[model samples]
Target: MQEFIPHRKCVGCMSIKPKKELLRIVRTDKGIFIDSKQKMPGRGAYICKDLECLKLAMKKKGLEKSLKVNISKDFYEKLEEFLKKLAVKSFDAEVWE
Candidate 1:
Protein backbone atom coordinates (compact mmCIF):
# COMPACT_ATOMS: atom_id res chain seq x y z
CA MET A 1 0.00 0.00 0.00
CA GLN A 2 1.11 3.48 -0.75
CA GLU A 3 1.85 5.77 2.19
CA PHE A 4 -0.10 8.90 2.86
CA ILE A 5 1.55 12.16 3.85
CA PRO A 6 -0.13 14.89 5.82
CA HIS A 7 0.41 18.46 4.64
CA ARG A 8 -0.51 21.65 6.42
CA LYS A 9 -0.31 25.35 5.63
CA CYS A 10 2.18 27.63 7.23
CA VAL A 11 0.52 30.78 8.51
CA GLY A 12 3.63 32.77 7.61
CA CYS A 13 4.24 31.71 3.99
CA MET A 14 0.88 30.03 3.32
CA SER A 15 2.71 27.07 1.86
CA ILE A 16 1.56 23.49 2.32
CA LYS A 17 4.19 21.08 3.57
CA PRO A 18 4.32 17.76 5.32
CA LYS A 19 3.13 17.97 8.92
CA LYS A 20 6.53 17.04 10.30
CA GLU A 21 8.08 19.96 8.45
CA LEU A 22 6.10 22.46 10.47
CA LEU A 23 5.98 23.57 14.09
CA ARG A 24 2.74 23.66 16.02
CA ILE A 25 1.65 26.62 18.17
CA VAL A 26 -1.35 25.84 20.28
CA ARG A 27 -3.75 27.47 22.72
CA THR A 28 -5.23 25.21 25.33
CA ASP A 29 -6.72 25.19 28.84
CA LYS A 30 -3.22 25.81 30.14
CA GLY A 31 -2.95 28.89 27.91
CA ILE A 32 -1.16 29.42 24.62
CA PHE A 33 2.22 27.77 23.93
CA ILE A 34 4.18 25.64 21.52
CA ASP A 35 3.36 21.93 21.25
CA SER A 36 6.16 19.91 19.70
CA LYS A 37 4.58 16.71 20.97
CA GLN A 38 1.59 17.31 18.66
CA LYS A 39 -0.77 15.71 21.15
CA MET A 40 -2.09 18.82 22.81
CA PRO A 41 -5.78 19.65 22.57
CA GLY A 42 -6.64 23.16 21.51
CA ARG A 43 -6.62 25.67 18.72
CA GLY A 44 -3.41 25.36 16.71
CA ALA A 45 -1.65 27.39 14.07
CA TYR A 46 1.25 25.98 12.15
CA ILE A 47 4.55 27.51 10.99
CA CYS A 48 7.28 26.18 8.75
CA LYS A 49 9.33 24.99 11.71
CA ASP A 50 12.00 27.48 10.70
CA LEU A 51 13.23 30.62 12.36
CA GLU A 52 12.13 32.69 9.38
CA CYS A 53 8.52 31.62 9.75
CA LEU A 54 8.71 32.07 13.51
CA LYS A 55 10.04 35.61 12.97
CA LEU A 56 7.37 36.47 10.45
CA ALA A 57 4.65 35.20 12.77
CA MET A 58 5.98 37.49 15.49
CA LYS A 59 6.46 40.52 13.25
CA LYS A 60 2.93 40.36 11.88
CA LYS A 61 1.34 39.08 15.07
CA GLY A 62 -0.19 36.33 13.01
CA LEU A 63 -0.53 33.88 15.84
CA GLU A 64 -2.20 36.36 18.15
CA LYS A 65 -4.72 37.18 15.47
CA SER A 66 -5.29 33.56 14.61
CA LEU A 67 -5.66 32.37 18.17
CA LYS A 68 -7.53 35.53 19.16
CA VAL A 69 -5.54 35.85 22.36
CA ASN A 70 -2.69 37.91 23.65
CA ILE A 71 0.66 36.16 23.69
CA SER A 72 2.99 37.38 26.36
CA LYS A 73 6.72 37.87 25.83
CA ASP A 74 7.32 35.22 28.48
CA PHE A 75 5.40 32.71 26.37
CA TYR A 76 7.39 33.74 23.35
CA GLU A 77 10.65 33.31 25.24
CA LYS A 78 9.73 29.87 26.53
CA LEU A 79 8.51 28.78 23.11
CA GLU A 80 11.70 30.06 21.50
CA GLU A 81 13.73 27.99 23.91
CA PHE A 82 11.58 24.95 23.08
CA LEU A 83 12.01 25.48 19.38
CA LYS A 84 15.77 25.49 19.82
CA LYS A 85 15.54 22.33 21.83
CA LEU A 86 13.34 20.72 19.18
CA ALA A 87 15.85 21.59 16.50
CA VAL A 88 18.52 19.82 18.50
CA LYS A 89 16.27 16.83 19.16
CA SER A 90 15.43 16.56 15.48
CA PHE A 91 19.02 15.59 14.83
CA ASP A 92 19.32 13.22 17.75
CA ALA A 93 20.78 9.78 16.99
CA GLU A 94 18.39 7.91 19.30
CA VAL A 95 14.98 6.67 18.29
CA TRP A 96 12.09 6.72 20.70
CA GLU A 97 10.11 4.18 18.74
Candidate 2:
Protein backbone atom coordinates (compact mmCIF):
# COMPACT_ATOMS: atom_id res chain seq x y z
CA MET A 1 0.00 0.00 0.00
CA GLN A 2 1.11 3.52 -0.70
CA GLU A 3 1.01 6.35 1.76
CA PHE A 4 -1.33 9.14 0.87
CA ILE A 5 -0.43 12.82 1.02
CA PRO A 6 -3.24 15.31 1.06
CA HIS A 7 -3.17 18.32 -1.26
CA ARG A 8 -4.77 21.75 -0.93
CA LYS A 9 -5.08 24.84 -3.06
CA CYS A 10 -3.50 28.10 -1.91
CA VAL A 11 -6.08 30.88 -1.82
CA GLY A 12 -3.30 33.38 -2.57
CA CYS A 13 -1.35 32.04 -5.51
CA MET A 14 -4.16 29.72 -6.47
CA SER A 15 -1.67 26.91 -6.84
CA ILE A 16 -2.28 23.34 -5.73
CA LYS A 17 0.32 22.13 -3.27
CA PRO A 18 0.77 19.36 -0.76
CA LYS A 19 -1.09 20.26 2.39
CA LYS A 20 2.02 20.08 4.53
CA GLU A 21 3.70 22.76 2.43
CA LEU A 22 0.95 25.27 3.03
CA LEU A 23 -0.01 27.27 6.10
CA ARG A 24 -3.48 26.63 7.44
CA ILE A 25 -5.63 29.46 8.77
CA VAL A 26 -8.88 28.66 10.47
CA ARG A 27 -11.88 30.59 11.71
CA THR A 28 -13.96 29.33 14.59
CA ASP A 29 -16.55 30.73 17.00
CA LYS A 30 -13.79 32.30 19.02
CA GLY A 31 -11.90 33.96 16.19
CA ILE A 32 -9.41 33.49 13.39
CA PHE A 33 -6.19 31.69 14.10
CA ILE A 34 -3.03 30.66 12.34
CA ASP A 35 -3.37 26.91 12.70
CA SER A 36 0.24 25.71 12.85
CA LYS A 37 -0.99 22.36 14.15
CA GLN A 38 -3.51 22.03 11.34
CA LYS A 39 -6.02 20.48 13.70
CA MET A 40 -8.35 23.35 14.50
CA PRO A 41 -12.00 22.58 14.02
CA GLY A 42 -13.62 25.22 11.89
CA ARG A 43 -13.77 26.68 8.43
CA GLY A 44 -10.14 26.44 7.28
CA ALA A 45 -8.25 27.95 4.42
CA TYR A 46 -4.71 27.33 3.18
CA ILE A 47 -2.09 29.61 1.74
CA CYS A 48 1.53 29.43 0.75
CA LYS A 49 4.09 30.48 3.33
CA ASP A 50 5.40 33.24 1.09
CA LEU A 51 4.58 36.83 1.95
CA GLU A 52 3.91 37.63 -1.70
CA CYS A 53 1.18 35.04 -1.72
CA LEU A 54 -0.37 36.69 1.29
CA LYS A 55 -0.40 40.00 -0.50
CA LEU A 56 -1.95 38.43 -3.56
CA ALA A 57 -4.68 36.87 -1.48
CA MET A 58 -5.46 40.22 0.08
CA LYS A 59 -5.40 41.96 -3.25
CA LYS A 60 -7.66 39.35 -4.85
CA LYS A 61 -9.90 38.86 -1.81
CA GLY A 62 -9.32 35.15 -2.15
CA LEU A 63 -9.11 34.43 1.55
CA GLU A 64 -12.24 36.40 2.27
CA LYS A 65 -14.18 34.60 -0.43
CA SER A 66 -13.04 31.16 0.63
CA LEU A 67 -13.54 31.76 4.35
CA LYS A 68 -16.87 33.51 3.67
CA VAL A 69 -16.15 36.26 6.16
CA ASN A 70 -14.91 39.79 6.11
CA ILE A 71 -11.42 40.03 7.54
CA SER A 72 -10.53 43.21 9.34
CA LYS A 73 -7.59 45.43 8.37
CA ASP A 74 -5.92 44.99 11.75
CA PHE A 75 -6.12 41.22 11.37
CA TYR A 76 -4.35 41.36 8.04
CA GLU A 77 -1.58 43.51 9.49
CA LYS A 78 -1.15 41.17 12.39
CA LEU A 79 -1.09 38.16 10.12
CA GLU A 80 1.58 39.80 8.00
CA GLU A 81 3.74 40.41 11.04
CA PHE A 82 3.25 36.80 12.12
CA LEU A 83 4.31 35.53 8.73
CA LYS A 84 7.41 37.71 8.85
CA LYS A 85 8.42 36.24 12.15
CA LEU A 86 7.80 32.76 10.85
CA ALA A 87 9.93 33.46 7.82
CA VAL A 88 12.76 34.69 9.98
CA LYS A 89 12.62 31.63 12.21
CA SER A 90 12.56 29.27 9.27
CA PHE A 91 15.48 31.05 7.66
CA ASP A 92 17.51 30.80 10.85
CA ALA A 93 16.72 27.12 11.13
CA GLU A 94 17.85 26.51 7.59
CA VAL A 95 21.07 28.38 8.18
CA TRP A 96 21.86 26.39 11.31
CA GLU A 97 21.08 23.17 9.55
Candidate 3:
Protein backbone atom coordinates (compact mmCIF):
# COMPACT_ATOMS: atom_id res chain seq x y z
CA MET A 1 0.00 0.00 0.00
CA GLN A 2 1.15 3.51 -0.77
CA GLU A 3 0.48 6.65 1.17
CA PHE A 4 -1.66 9.29 -0.44
CA ILE A 5 0.12 12.53 -1.25
CA PRO A 6 -1.99 15.66 -1.51
CA HIS A 7 -1.47 17.80 -4.60
CA ARG A 8 -2.17 21.52 -5.06
CA LYS A 9 -2.03 23.90 -7.98
CA CYS A 10 0.39 26.83 -8.06
CA VAL A 11 -1.40 30.08 -8.80
CA GLY A 12 1.68 31.46 -10.56
CA CYS A 13 2.80 28.60 -12.75
CA MET A 14 -0.61 26.99 -12.82
CA SER A 15 1.07 23.64 -12.34
CA ILE A 16 -0.12 20.82 -10.17
CA LYS A 17 2.42 19.75 -7.56
CA PRO A 18 2.63 18.02 -4.24
CA LYS A 19 1.24 20.18 -1.47
CA LYS A 20 4.43 19.83 0.54
CA GLU A 21 6.49 21.07 -2.36
CA LEU A 22 4.80 24.47 -2.56
CA LEU A 23 4.74 27.49 -0.29
CA ARG A 24 1.38 28.31 1.28
CA ILE A 25 0.29 31.91 1.77
CA VAL A 26 -2.82 32.26 3.86
CA ARG A 27 -5.15 35.16 4.52
CA THR A 28 -7.04 35.11 7.77
CA ASP A 29 -9.06 37.67 9.68
CA LYS A 30 -5.83 38.66 11.32
CA GLY A 31 -3.99 39.20 8.06
CA ILE A 32 -1.96 37.48 5.39
CA PHE A 33 1.08 35.47 6.34
CA ILE A 34 3.20 32.70 5.08
CA ASP A 35 1.79 29.47 6.42
CA SER A 36 4.99 27.49 6.67
CA LYS A 37 3.27 24.97 8.88
CA GLN A 38 0.28 24.88 6.56
CA LYS A 39 -1.89 24.99 9.65
CA MET A 40 -3.09 28.57 9.33
CA PRO A 41 -6.85 28.61 9.21
CA GLY A 42 -8.08 30.78 6.39
CA ARG A 43 -8.15 31.17 2.63
CA GLY A 44 -4.84 29.89 1.27
CA ALA A 45 -3.02 30.18 -2.03
CA TYR A 46 -0.17 27.92 -3.05
CA ILE A 47 2.83 28.89 -5.16
CA CYS A 48 5.98 27.26 -6.38
CA LYS A 49 9.11 27.65 -4.25
CA ASP A 50 10.78 29.62 -6.98
CA LEU A 51 11.18 33.41 -6.94
CA GLU A 52 9.93 33.62 -10.51
CA CYS A 53 6.68 32.05 -9.49
CA LEU A 54 6.31 34.52 -6.65
CA LYS A 55 6.91 37.42 -9.01
CA LEU A 56 4.39 36.09 -11.49
CA ALA A 57 1.80 35.60 -8.79
CA MET A 58 2.33 39.16 -7.64
CA LYS A 59 2.09 40.58 -11.14
CA LYS A 60 -1.09 38.66 -11.90
CA LYS A 61 -2.70 39.43 -8.54
CA GLY A 62 -3.38 35.74 -8.13
CA LEU A 63 -2.95 35.76 -4.38
CA GLU A 64 -5.37 38.61 -4.02
CA LYS A 65 -7.93 36.76 -6.11
CA SER A 66 -7.45 33.53 -4.22
CA LEU A 67 -7.71 35.16 -0.85
CA LYS A 68 -10.28 37.72 -1.98
CA VAL A 69 -8.29 40.49 -0.29
CA ASN A 70 -5.93 43.24 -1.25
CA ILE A 71 -2.31 42.28 -0.73
CA SER A 72 0.03 45.00 0.40
CA LYS A 73 3.46 45.81 -0.94
CA ASP A 74 4.91 45.28 2.51
CA PHE A 75 3.55 41.76 2.56
CA TYR A 76 5.19 41.09 -0.77
CA GLU A 77 8.46 42.51 0.49
CA LYS A 78 8.32 40.30 3.54
CA LEU A 79 7.55 37.28 1.42
CA GLU A 80 10.47 38.11 -0.84
CA GLU A 81 12.76 38.35 2.14
CA PHE A 82 11.56 35.01 3.43
CA LEU A 83 12.08 33.40 0.04
CA LYS A 84 15.56 34.87 -0.15
CA LYS A 85 16.38 33.38 3.20
CA LEU A 86 15.22 30.01 1.93
CA ALA A 87 17.45 30.50 -1.16
CA VAL A 88 14.86 28.85 -3.33
CA LYS A 89 16.08 28.67 -6.91
CA SER A 90 14.41 25.68 -8.47
CA PHE A 91 11.92 23.00 -7.57
CA ASP A 92 14.07 20.54 -5.71
CA ALA A 93 11.88 17.65 -4.65
CA GLU A 94 14.56 16.15 -2.45
CA VAL A 95 14.98 19.30 -0.38
CA TRP A 96 11.27 19.70 0.25
CA GLU A 97 10.48 16.05 0.93
Q: Which number leads on TM-score?
A: 2
Candidate 3: where is the Cα deviation over 4 Å?
88-97
lDDT of 1 by residue, 1-97 (tens): 9999988788777789988788778898888867676667999888876767777778888788888899898877775665676678565312211
Give the lDDT of residue 33 in candidate 1: 62
Candidate 2, residue 81: how far the Cα is off, in Å:
1.0
TM value for model 1: 0.77
Angstrom error at residue 63, model 1: 0.8
After superposition, candidate 1 runs with Cα above 4 Å error: 89-97
| Best of the two (1, 3) by TM-score | 3
Q: Cα lDDT of all candidates, in order?
A: 0.75, 0.84, 0.84
- Looking at model 3, residue 47 earns an lDDT score of 90
| Runs with alpha carbons beyond 4 Å of true place in candidate 2 | 90-97
Ranking of models by TM-score: 2, 3, 1
Q: How close is candidate 2 to the true structure, as a TM-score?
A: 0.88
Model 1 clash pairs are none
lDDT agreement of model 3 with the native: 0.84
User: Per-prediction RMSD in angstroms?
Assistant: 3.7, 4.4, 4.7
Positional deviation of 32 in candidate 3, in angstroms? 0.4
